[model samples]
Target: MSIAPKPNPALAELAVLEGEWVIELSNAKFLPGSNSRAQGRVSAEWLDNSALVMRQWQWRRQGDLDHRA
Candidate 1:
């Protein structure tokens, strides 16, 4: 079996951002005739005993770009 690596000192410093966040887009008109608006969420967490940090994002509405990394 594989083992989890030790936590990195540098990764510990990023703990402050370990949580969920809401995203918003306004007046970022990708189209015409009106101001466009959208919303989504972003989440960050430690992986493998803080050996790495993983972040994922998703946007509201449609058109691809809807998955975890």
Candidate 2:
């Protein structure tokens, strides 16, 4: 038989971030040639109450799609 350990107190505190977020970046002068604007969505959740996992989907102003898993 196996038992799961309790989550760390500090880690559990991070549960407050468990939700969806809308992100926007405007006039970011990182690129040399063109101004950059982006919109994205982030989803955060706790996995098995042990690990915090975040997934993100983003679209650049030029219609480029980015995803992180």
lDDT of 1 at 62: 46
TM-score of each: 0.51, 0.59
Off by over 4 Å in 2: 1-5, 26-35, 62-69
Q: Whole-model lDDT for model 2 versus the true structure?
A: 0.71
Query: 1-69, model 1: which lDDT tens digit per residue?
Result: 987688888777788778888877676656232555566888878787664354788776444355444
Q: Candidate 2, residues 1-69: lDDT per residue as tens digits?
A: 978767877796788888898877776775333566676777888877788888555544446657454
List runs of model 1 lying over 4 Å from the truth. Answer: 1-4, 26-35, 61-69
Error (Å) of candidate 2 at residue 20 is 0.8
Candidate 1 TM-score, C-alpha based: 0.51
Residue 40, model 2: lDDT of 72
lDDT of model 2 at residue 6?
79
Clashing pairs in 2: none
Count steric clashes of candidate 2: 0
Which whole-number lDDT from 0 to 100 does residue 42 have in model 1? 83
